[model samples]
Target: MRRMTPARRILLLVAACVFLACTAVPAWRGAKIAYHLHTARYLLGQGELAQALSWLAYPLQEQPRSAEVHYLLGNTYRRQGNFDRALRHLAKARQYGWRREEVDLQVVLIDVQRGDVEAADPLLDRAAVHAVPDDVAVEVYEALAKGYLALHRIEDAMVVLDTWIQWQPRAVQPRLWRARIHERENDWDRAAAEYRQILSVKPDDVPALLGMAGALLARNEPVQALPYFRRCTELAPDPTQAQLGLAQCLRRLGRGAEAGQLIARLLRGSLTLEQQATAHYELGLLALADHRLHAAIRHLQTAVDLAPQHIALRDALAEALEKAGKSRQAASHRQQAERLRQQEDRISRLLAALAESPHNPDLRCDAGDALMQGGYPREAVRWYMNALKIDPEHRRAHESLARYYEAIDMPDLAAEHRQHATQAGAQPQLSKPDQPDGLRGDGPPPTPKACGPVQDQPPLQKLEQRAGPP
Candidate 1:
């Protein structure tokens, strides 16, 4: 109990100080980590992604083993659009045995954003195969579906989306994805059904409403789709696309003035060059539908000027100019279109002539090509039929007829052709006359003269009816 030796006292003092320092170190580090984590989260909430990233960096350095820090950092990076860094941190989070499913999903999403779908495929596969929680499993499936969609593997996307929907019927995402896939496949009825299912689940879902409107418009059911389009307009943040879609639906439903007003509003907004051109083009078409040729010409000309590369807009402008009696401008556009059309026609005719010879099974399919190129799609049906008649198993002909019928709004006929094509083991064919040579050569020739608008027939005269009326 008396005074200790100097060396012993020094050693004892150092030992006590060391114990205190060791104890304080963890608390200090823990506090620092907590503070940084909270600050990072706050910055993220405020959308200050860069600031959040800086805050997350310190915590990550201090607690290199911390999974939560890695995950938060990944999220911050993702928000900042630094997909590579986001992926690196997310992968680390998974490696550290963090929320494996959530980190895996972030990795998949980043891969998709970076267009590394092939890389994402294995991660998605692993996530699906693993014993993940239900909510996490749904997320993995959704991510896989999105990955497939990004790669344009639509059927694959549908398979994933359908699986998710079966597991969670109440989930709107799966239905929304299913609708998107259907829309891409031009299966408007199926797309509309899926969209309706989403709406039933989430009545206020703007995307579902917009999708429903689009599907209805595609099916020529604009009248029925109007309410959904209006709802989409009401719920959308910017409401530009919804408003544009509404305008289209209204125009299709013969509500020209209402459509015009919506188009006018869209035009007044700060739109991208492409959007501006599209808006002008749509307004022109609306004007044309209303028989306001001068106004149509004005909007169409502006559209053409804005987007000279848009062949459809240019063609529309020419048509409007012709209706407005601007013969010179119309003639110029017609000349351009004719030049392009002639180039296509030459190839089609050559193919047709070769096919007409009957010697080359490949060339015989050309008759469909010629019919389509010559703007005699209805006649193209005959050529395709004749080709199929010669080679009862001609796949190209069936595929072509299916596409032509679809274009002409004859879904039943199109389905029949598609069935025949599928039976013949042929790929789907496009309705365009200038399709790839592979499409013409590989499958049955397309239907001949299948898509032209029907001319209104003259009213029948009834002498007996006239006498009765008198």
Candidate 2:
């Protein structure tokens, strides 16, 4: 070999530097895209849809044809109930190397969510026949069951849950859900049997224990319920419900003093509004059993105030008031109770209509309106959320949520929904007429930041070195 000149050596060095640059830039770009994709997936799993959408935007802008990116973007949109955008991205995913088998299940889920179950049926039938991965099978089965229940197709929901159990006998969720359906039908014996099966598999399962106790109590077998409720109280982190059930059983078994003391202790602790109402109701029942009419009336009235929608509480309060010779007060409560019952009936009719026309946002809104009138604002929120899920731009739903969030003192969430309601072309009727629409007047809604701490990324130099100068 000839001895190379310094200039030639320098030329070779320059060429090597150019080659490294060429390889490194693409490698670094690919790594950045991958990082964004992985972060988006994590955010999606965390239920941070807004953050996930932001993260996905980067990879999508960089590699619009990337199959994984398109699939993930499709999922993000699907979760947001932007079904048109979801389907468009999913089509792109299929066009760019994602298999039809993997993509079809998601499409089925979208159809189910959109209340197009008939359109999803053929795809579901195909999925049932094929051997899919266990995770995929679980997701499909769960979605089908939920959709069926939403449509009030009880038999179909049962069939889906039964199939889920048959395929995955060891799975607890399907069995638990099956038991709940039985409970809903008032089949205490069947519910108890299902709970027993779960307890046999996982002896310390608090939900199963609570279910067994509730079923036995419904069957008027407090003797059988006591031990289960006791076990649940021992196992559950928040044993309020279990303790209440235990107290109920004790009172029924002629241990009213013990039950009253347990309830008194429970009332002194921190609890949700619902839990506090239940505790008060139990205490009222104990006082009533002891023939303390005034005490009973006070406790029951407090329960009625806390949970205004509970028919039983109103009736119980009226009963105590009547016993105390306050007939006028009792009559007023009874009339209010009747009005609530009628409103509930209206809500049920609207919900039944929704089952027939599952995608009807107006039906859902009507149900929410009825629930709100009946003083069930929390439950009404769920109905509004359901309406939004079917029709993202439903003005009434956004207006309802804005009012709810404002009442709860969540200004940021309230402002967001208010802005949405405004953009949907309706003037939102704020609960407080003087409340300012900050997002509306302040230019635009604030951008959502990515959730959690930022993860460190490898420098381009390190990534290039790892790729080794293609």
Best by TM-score: 2
In order, the Cα lDDT scores of the candidates are 0.67, 0.75
List TM-scores for all candidates, in order.
0.52, 0.58
Query: Residue 348 CA error for candidate 2 (Å)?
Result: 3.3
On lDDT, the candidate that comes out on top is 2
- TM-score of model 1 vs. true structure: 0.52
Which stretches in model 2 have alpha-carbon errors above 4 Å? 1-132, 143-156, 356-362, 381-470
Give the Å shift of residue 444 in candidate 1. 26
Screening candidate 2 with a backbone cut-off below 3 angstroms (N, C-alpha, C), the clashing residue pairs are none
